[model samples]
Target: MDIQEKARPPAEVYDAQFVPALFAQWGQVVCAEASVREGDRILDVACGTGALTLAAADIAGPSGSVVGLDVNPEMLAVARRKPAQIEWLEGAAEALPFPDNSFDAVVSQFGFMFFEDKPKALAEMMRVLKPKGGLAVAVCDAVENSPGYGAFALLLDRLFGKEAGNAFRAPFSLGEAGQLTAICREAGLSHAEVVRRNGKVRFKSIDALVSTERACAWTLGGVLNDEQFERLLNESLSVLEPFTVDSGAVEFGMASLIIKARKV
Candidate 1:
């Protein structure tokens, strides 16, 4: 939990741990839904460590062009080291640097929840897409929908405080399909369609799960002191035991709301 000053950056932990456990599979899903094609221009907004962006590049191929953009330079730095002939840009979602109608498709995975101006960010995505370009976004479903996480959230509340607990639920903030659909419509992304899909999360052990969240800014955001994090970890052993498999790895069901739309 105490990512020491000399420790590997949190972004590295995310690419090494979080991506394989959660975001990696969804990368293909988002790209496919966004209709990424060879020789097409593609943009991945909030493309942390190039999960979805890498997927897009493969599909787009040597003939196609792909760009990954994110506000966090630390994350982008991690992305740049990956071996891919694609552009990696550092920028905000609310104000994309590309010109209008620039990309054939735009996609994001599990990043929309962090956008401060959701509507404006969605609009910016739409604005950059070529006419009739595809758009897709995937956000984790609510904490209530994920049993293990729900228990963890309650544990956080019981131990740390409501604020600490709420931080854990931030990724699930946009879980409601209706709310996301409304945001798309309001952003001038016409005919947005949302579908609920089941997903799964896995970690080597309960301790790995707890420690990963402790390091992830998207989740715990370093709110807990080292002692408090250790406390949470100890308590989670019992709270999350139901989801732990015989191999001692923690596995549980999750859901994501995949929003698909097109620019007209």
Candidate 2:
């Protein structure tokens, strides 16, 4: 399957497995960093299953308006089940459907890296924000900096191929702070600041981590046969043993870069 197809997982799996494990904390951080106010109009671009969108809606309150836009209909379908107060729209980040200067804040959590046209997406985000409005984005750092994901990618490469491994690496492709800042500037969002922070990646167990990856992670589900998946589970448990804590949960350090900017 193509990368796009691989990236699309069952909405149920995404909401149940991926969101709580990873995206939820980043959602809170991104919305807070973006300064989503009680009555501010907010836009969440590439909002996968509304992790950030829901957070923004809660922060924006009833007086404020929040819209969650994504190119994936399945993702939007999942998000639509959330608070009716938040408008969930289907659209691409490269060409947002909204009019210019329509939002007080635009925030994306772990979504900017997947846009096919980074510059155009940045431009659209800039175009939608009110003057001096904030934009915040969080993206994963290098795979090397995330030991769990690094090991996962290496195992995928060994088991599948480089193509399969690329799915894991793609999210971290734009991890560099300089690259992120340059993109914002190139898209006319000058004065962008990129901050790197360390975060913890935790899972109840090695099996839980592998199951979540197979269910929600890109290019993982449907690629491995039953036997292969079992082997992978065993291998992952072995690989993650060093990171297992006293409670038998796997916890590892992962770094992320949060890019903050404002329209001039």
Candidate 3:
């Protein structure tokens, strides 16, 4: 399946299965860095399922405004159901529908790597922000730094060759701190700060993790045949064995970079 097709999973599956497992913690971290105030206006660009958007809304309080914008209508659909107060809009990062200098802060979590025109998108993000507005973005680190993901990539390469591996690696494309900061500078965002942090990724069991991967539209979903899927599950069990704790649950360290900047 193509990248677009892979990204079009049902909203419920994504929210129920993927959010708690991988996105919730990062959402909190990104929102905290945004430094939203009681009356601030915040925009979450590419806010998948409104994870970060919801967190921002709590900080923004009753008088403040928080808008969750996404290119996918399905994601917006799910986001709208969460908080009745926050506005959910269907839009792309490259061309924000809001007026210039409309928001006091902008934040994105694990979404920048997927933008087709990142420079244009960054420019648009800055254009919508008030002067001195903060911008916080979080992206996964390189696959090598993430052992579990590294193993998965190696397995995909062994099974389906380079294309499959590349697809798996797309999320980590902007892994380097220097590269991310440079991109922000090129897009006219000044004094960008990039920090690397470790987050814990956990799964109740190996089967649970494998199930999520198979169901995730952006991962190996629909790519593996029944037999290949079975083989992948069995093979991955061995690979993840080391990360499994005495309680039978699996946990691993995940490294990610948080890039903070201001529209000076």
Candidate 4:
């Protein structure tokens, strides 16, 4: 079956399933890189379900201010329910709602790759940062560098087609260090550097990994029919077994890049 455009995944499922397993840990990493301090004003663009935004708020503390913005109202709804007292706004990265020079630090984790206009979004991020403000943006490393996913992507191609394969591969669009650094420079950000870091991806089981992808529009959500989904799930058992530990959880090493810069 061919991949079809679909509504973004259900935010509740995203928040409940993938957030803890995949995105939560990176929150602190991005916040630390952005140098979020006790009283800094921070912004999290494309703050899906507020995983990274929550981390930023903790670092920023009660005295500090943090805002989480996303285009999806569903995601923002989930984010707004989080316990932290931070601002949750419905917005897009390409056009930030606040005034220019609005934040002491800006951090986005694993979110930039999906922007409709990457250049415009990056410029918008730069526009909102105060001079010398920290900028830390994270994206998945290239498919080639992420072996488990790389193999899974190819399997998708075999089972579905290039379109399905690409759907799975889409998240790593900003993987190259040089390319990311160049993009930052082109956006007029200063001292931009892209550092690749290793991370672990853990799913409670092989089924969990397959199911999570099925729930996410960025990956396989609308792409797989029930039969296709079952086929992929069944096929993935043996394919993903190498990464599965004795406890039946799937674990693999993934890489991510953090593009750090200053707005000076």
Candidate 5:
């Protein structure tokens, strides 16, 4: 299957109310360091649920502009309802709708892994950015680094073997710092740097977290089947039994890498 189809969830669960808030919290932190000047135009590619878009909007203020684009209509819908000031557009990262050198800054949060054509998306991001403009993209580190999700991943592998597991090259391709920097260079970006980030993966409950798996379609794509999926769902809940804390809340140590580059 193509990337888009593979990325589509079983249903449009992103329309849920809490989804936007969930993403916005971390999105703000991810784009926190990006410097924006007055009247600067920014583009948020793969703007899932408008997390980066909303953050960019906050940075751009009124005089400046922030354009959020994503291929998923469901995600765009969730993004549009937030404040209504951010310009929400439906587009693919591989083929941006803006002209060359159109944006002062381009940012993405946890999106580079899902791109079918990494080079194409990076090229598009570069083309839309003005000379010497900034680009920042963040991606989850490898499964080994993200130990917080160890139980969750173990359950998945138990249910589905290595073949259909989450080991698919797509998600793990840029998991390494060196690999991510190399990808930036290959995409025609310069002055690349990778920042290691430690974060938390919080969940209300194991079941709730597993249920939201559908919303994280891009990651679970092609990783599970009907029988295997159900088995994993049930097994994961059992695995999370010991980790239960107060109020059905659980937090795990998460690791990620922030790749910053310059369009020159």
Candidate 6:
């Protein structure tokens, strides 16, 4: 598999089973911060498979409207197969296709990492929010904060060695709380709160983990050519062989960051 094409595994893997569960996991926290009320319009940026969009629909009720936006057609296809209660639009976070101050709230789950330009995306998120509207973007902290990922990453490094394995950069400025605060401030967000949600999702086995790696292609960023990709894949699989038990079912937990703010 071309690793760069599928770098964000969480988006693709969770497009099925995990997306809804992740929504259910953070539903209340997001709703509480979003301050959703009847008749309020909401926007879910990079809505992925529409988990947060559906969650926003639940909170917005029939009176409020929820618009889900995503740039990935494959992911959007999975989202479209769901019920048609939500308005799913094709768009990018860096350039939202909505009027200024159009939404009472804007929410994104685990999407900031994929953004090529975070400040530009944040500014767009701010622009879409109505005056005083809330914005909540959830992202996972560094691998160190997430135990399952740390172990998974360690295994990758051991198998691929430091040179080839360090392709994973946690993808965002998540480890720097101060940096996040400053970004929010620059984006014209006020009353911001950086909350840590220490949570974990258990995989049935190591094969499941491998499946996730294959589908998402986390580490091989363009640096790994076809030969290196095959070698790394074989080496990683060999390393994971011992961890496979009871048909390769294993449990792994993740710690995530839930940053909430209000557009000034």
Please report the candidate that would top TM-score against the real structure. 1
| Poorest stretch of ten by lDDT in candidate 5 | 1-10
- Across 6-51, the per-residue lDDT of candidate 2 in tens digits comes to 3445776778766776777777788877878899999999998999
Question: Cα lDDT of all candidates, in order?
Answer: 0.88, 0.82, 0.81, 0.86, 0.70, 0.69
| Candidate 6 structure quality by residue, lDDT tens digits, 1-264 | 444434554555656435533344665566567686677798888888887788788878888998889988777878888885888889889999988989999888777877777778888988889988988887767776655556656766776666544555454246557767777776665567888776555556544444444555434344555565565556555564544446655544566677787766
Model 3: per-residue Cα lDDT over 1-264, one tens digit each: 122323446666677656777787787688767666788899999998987888888888888999999999888888888845898889999999989999999999888988988778889988899998988888889988988778878987997788777877888899998898788878876677888878877877777776767666676666776676667778878888888986878778788898887777
What global local distance difference test value does model 1 have? 0.88
Instruction: Flag the better candidate by lDDT, 2 or 6.
Output: 2
Clashing pairs in 6: 200-253, 200-254, 204-249, 204-250, 205-248, 205-249, 205-250, 206-248
| Candidate 4, residue 63: how far the Cα is off, in Å | 0.9
**Residue range 23-58, candidate 5, lDDT tens digits:** 445566566544555677999998877767777787
Ranking by lDDT: 1, 4, 2, 3, 5, 6
Deviation in Å, model 2, residue 201 alpha carbon: 1.7
User: TM-scores for all candidates?
Assistant: 0.95, 0.90, 0.91, 0.94, 0.83, 0.80
Worst 10 residues of 3 by lDDT: 1-10
Give the range of the ten consecutive residues with the poorest summed lDDT in model 6: 1-10
Residues forming the 10-long window of minimal summed lDDT in candidate 2: 1-10
> What does candidate 3 score on TM?
0.91
* Lowest-sum lDDT 10-residue window in model 1: 1-10
